[model samples]
Target: MVLQILFIAIALAGVALFSYNLKKVIRNIRIGKAANRTDQPQKRMMTMVKVALGQTKMFFRPIPAFLHLIVYAGFVIINIEVLEIMIDGIFGTHRVFGGMGALYNFLIASFEILALGVWLGCAIFLIRRNIIKLKRFSGVEMKGWPKSDANYILITEILLMTAFLVMNAADAKLQAMGAAHYTTVGSFPVSQFLMNLLPNTEGALIAIERGCWWFHIVGIFGFLNYLPYSKHFHIMFAFPNTYFSNLEPKGEFSNMQSVTNEVKAMLDPSFTPPEAEAGKFGAKDVNDLTWVNLMNAYTCTECGRCTSVCPANITGKLLSPRKIMMDTRDRLEEVGKNIDKTGNGFDDGKSLIDSYISREEIWACTSCNACTQACPINIDPLAIITELRRYAVMEESQAPASINAMLGNIENNGAPWKYSPADRLNWAKES
Candidate 1:
């Protein structure tokens, strides 16, 4: 009865989670729209697949990357055991892989070792985030965030994974003590050692074994249900986000509608045209943003690599690349929910430059492309900043005086520095 109940519970939970994730996938696809790309479709797909499955981005930090590689590899390989357990729950039989007992034992030992490595990695990450207190790790000026939420999610994942390992060890010990000696004696040395310490009574061993199994199963299910609402949501979001990353000419900017055509009729001969409504110039809400930009927000892992590389953040500028992504995501979720409830979308009249992000924060960016180059998931922060700049200067006429002066000089003298046009040939002369 206990086994039967466990089977039913696992099946129901798995179905529910699969259904929920499917709906989210469909919704994101509909929202993503159609993007024109300059890169060959096949090349872009290959790059995305390599990065997503290969853990390419985590390698920015070698120690963390190595540890994560072990854990990731183990997670992928050890899922066979999970499938076997699910099968056993459905059928009365326990072991599903009858032919490869030796291989199964070897895999179990490998996963156990990897689980230990993962624990160490989690410890290092926790220490870095909490004790080291590096500026880059802070992400942004926003006080509560990533520091708190990120820590919570990381700790929970570590705990859950640790529980899985403990439960396995206990189950192995129980099996070795019982009359059913299914496993090869020499292959499972750790279980053999553990069996020496445990009681021989069937009822007592069975109770303990059942308790551990329940913990393992419940831990997995709880982790799944909590995922979407937690910082760890990125685990699920990252896959699809990577799959749909922008695959275009990195040097080129997205084209905007011709401003002349849209506003020519609105112009009055006697009066200057009032600034076009705000949301028209830059993204003020989720719907206003390109689908790729939205996916960038979802994909960010808050790993602080971008924040570490950001020149502005390095120089004590208020910008944190990670925070920029987080803030955009937060604002999008907030505005999306409001729009959903009220059926009234963005304010539509306010420029993103003046309302959403400050001019100082925007202009402080040096276009060094460090953030873009550093992002693990191919998020192009520099591109977004440049697009916003284009809107501000060309559409809104809200650029700083220095920028206007530079433009004027370029127009009058054919150079931004007001150098003589004749001097252009001087560089070619021997100097």
Candidate 2:
């Protein structure tokens, strides 16, 4: 009774810690300027179901896709077993659903199969990242912490799954011996082999079972806490990110509303443009960006798929869409920490444009939607890149000489070339 009470207290404390961190993330996201994404509710629901839940975008690359599916499905579906673990932990019971005989056996068998899949999938991913040397997995962006993080997640998952299997094996052995607290609950089709590796001593067997059980649950709590600080936060945020994806055509770029409103008043005589909103011409920092852009930052997987397909990156230009996302996330984290420390507003004076993402990288973009399409989580790194460019051009008038010449031509002659509009008919006659 005392042990169960202590376990329940630990479980509640773990949950509390997770909730507090999650709220911090939510608060950080809300720091961005508001834009309404509340439109198209039904379509949003279907999109979340199709893209995030189904992981349809991942299937574009077959081998990695299938392997990812194994680990992802295992992580999600096998977690149903966690419910039983929780109930048993809290109530001092052993496999509370054990009474549902055949169904329970089938569920356990399925979990074991998926656990095996997760183990295999992690192993292959480790090989692809470390040994086989996938090009996308290395590079400046993935050099130190990013590379280590991927390996850490994969290895931790392997160990967690192993602990689960070991726990089941030891439990099954105890059941065969008609032990007291370790009930005859689960089917160990995969774990039965592990039983032979365990000791013949009953006390030693009990220790192994308890050790594995406690480790599995404790590891899960640790992983849960780690998500807020890791790219793995996407495991929770991916659904909402996909659901709120830009519903417009991918080729379209979102205009800066402040600039657009200015142009609207100039063109439409009857248009009563609302009083000019006060903000930077475009995003100079993370807070200047829309909440959606910030959300994209938080959700980035750092998978480098955006960089892999980038025309600018391929052609040796400075732009890397993956780096843009990382920069945004890094800047956001910096700002978040600053806020926490100083309790002051985001007036640290350091901006993402100059400090983190350089003008060369932002200007190198062809504005191609390749990066947008390549991101599995629907992250729009190109949008952030464009935002920075917009800030440079509109606020600082720092457009290149060639672009300035084109703009001058447009202003004088209503065309890209420096010819009067009245002379436009001369071209047809000459032709």
Candidate 3:
């Protein structure tokens, strides 16, 4: 009874703490302006199914994708055993599902196999990131905590899997010794080989089994809480983010509604423009961006796929799409913290522009959508970049000399060149 009470308390506390943190994340996401992603609900559902559930885009790189698929499958399948653990924990029963007989055996055996796959997959990933030092894993944005976070996650998985296997091995040994409360259940194809290493004494076996049981559950709880602060939070946010993906043509830029309204008012004598919204041109901070844009920032996995395929980054420019997402998330978190410290109206005098992201980085993008195409989860860093550029041009009236000259030509000549429409054909007029 005491053990069951302790287990229940720990589980409840872990869940409560996680809920509080997640509420803060949702509130932060809601700080941004509204967007119309509810249109085409069927298409959005299918998008989530294809990308987040099917993981079709991960196959662009076969090796890592296969490894990731193994880990993903393993993590999901093995967690089914956690259900049994919870039931047993709550009732102080030993292997409550063991009464299912052959079915239980099959489930346990399959879990062991998958646990092994997760173990090996995580090991290889760690080697690739640390020993091999893959180019995608090394960058200005990946330096401090991002690099360490990946390593920590892999190491933690390996430890959890080890604990799980060791616990099974100890339990099997205890059952063979006819120990009290040690039921003869489960077929351990993988942990069976590990039995010889354990002791013959029943007390020692029980201690080992129970210790590992506690460790595995506690580690899972810790990992659950750690996810929100880590890049791995994509495991949860990826579905909604992919569902709300922009389904428009990649090359098409969304015209600012404010600008369109102003233009219409100028052209028509009696046209009444709608009242300005937030009275801001483009996004100067997180509050100015759409909610989906903010969600995209939070969903970024920092896998560097977007940055790796980015033309600007490839051509030695400072515009890393991964960095742009990271900057937005970091700045948004900063704003959230400021609001928590002071009231809702608090301002730290910092904005997303100039403070986190630079004008040069924003201007370096070719708007080719290569980054968006390469992302496995469809995170659109290009959207954030475009907003930053818009704020610079319309609000600050600040742009590079070349861009200013181009805008001048567009306004006067109706094109992005010095020549007029009449002279557009002069070059091809056999001159």
Candidate 4:
């Protein structure tokens, strides 16, 4: 009765959490608009298959990637065992892959080996994140996050996997002590070896087996409940996030619409345009951004891949690509409530250029597209930076003086270098 209730509760919780997240994802997809690009259907489908199904991005870093693959594959394959356990717990009988019983045993053995691989992989990841402290692996430096979150998650995953192995081991021992189960004979070796060491007592071995089963089930369910709130939330979100990632021209900026001009034109066409408003354009709040931009903020795994590849960051500029995502997410969270209450989400008077992202940071971008290229989830930081640049130069006239001089030269001299137009043909003739 206890087992039945526990199984039902866990099953319900899993379904509820998955359903809520799935609904949010669907809502985002319906609302999120990507600019129509050529051959989009093929591109989108291929990207979905390659990145989402193939686990391509995780492979960019070999050790972590390999470990992740093991864990991912194990999680998928071992789910059969989980279902069997649930059914047995409820019905008091094993109802699983009955035909090709030998193959089923082989599958179980494979997952057992894979479980150990996952534990080892997670251990290596923990060491790299905490002790080794590589700059590339340093995710967003949240101010108040407990230092123990990563450690705790890693330890829990390892313990859970170990419990699974121990459960099998305990079962193998029971089988050797005169149990006639086919799964016990061929599905586990470590447990079988350990069982030989135990006394031939059915009651004692059965008790041990039951304890391990409970431990394994409890650990797995506990981890599942904790997943959404943790950094490991990416484990579930990443696949969908990758599938729905924005694929657009990385070099271009989104067109910004000006409200001041529209308002003034509506009020009085004869009134002269405001000088201060001439060049003011950029996103001042979440609603001002495109839905895709908003989705980008939520999809960020805080993996620091963008930060690592940022030329601005490498050259000692104040901008961290990771921080751009973090800041956007933070501000969205802050202003979202206000937007919800009042339905006023636009920039009343604040300029995003001066207020949120500084001029120095905006100008520091080289437009090298390295950040975009390095991103695993197709986040185009270069494009975001360029959009801000467009707002600064065209809308606000707040660009560096050098840019104005260059533009002037382009206008009057027909060259950005301030060279005479007559000299353009001279170089060609000489060459």
Name the best candidate (by TM-score).
Answer: 3
lDDT of candidate 1 over 41-96, digit per residue (tens): 67767776777777787787787688767766766665666676677567755556
TM-score of the candidate numbered 2? Answer: 0.96
- What's the residue-level lDDT of 23 in candidate 2? 85
293-342 in candidate 4: lDDT tens per residue?
Answer: 65566666667777887878887778877666656555555454344567
Alpha carbon lDDT of residue 103, candidate 3?
99
The runs of at least 3 residues in candidate 2 whose Cα sits more than 4 Å from the true structure, single-residue gaps closed, are 267-272
- Write the residue-wise lDDT of candidate 3 on 94-141 in tens digits: 999999999999999999999999999999999999999999998899
Clashing pairs in 1: 278-349, 278-350, 278-351
- Clashing residue pairs in all predictions, respectively, total 3, 0, 0, 4
lDDT of 1 at 250: 60
> lDDT per model, in order?
0.64, 0.87, 0.91, 0.65
Task: Find the number of clashing residue pairs for candidate 1.
Answer: 3
TM-score of 4: 0.76
Error of 1 at 116 (Å): 2.1
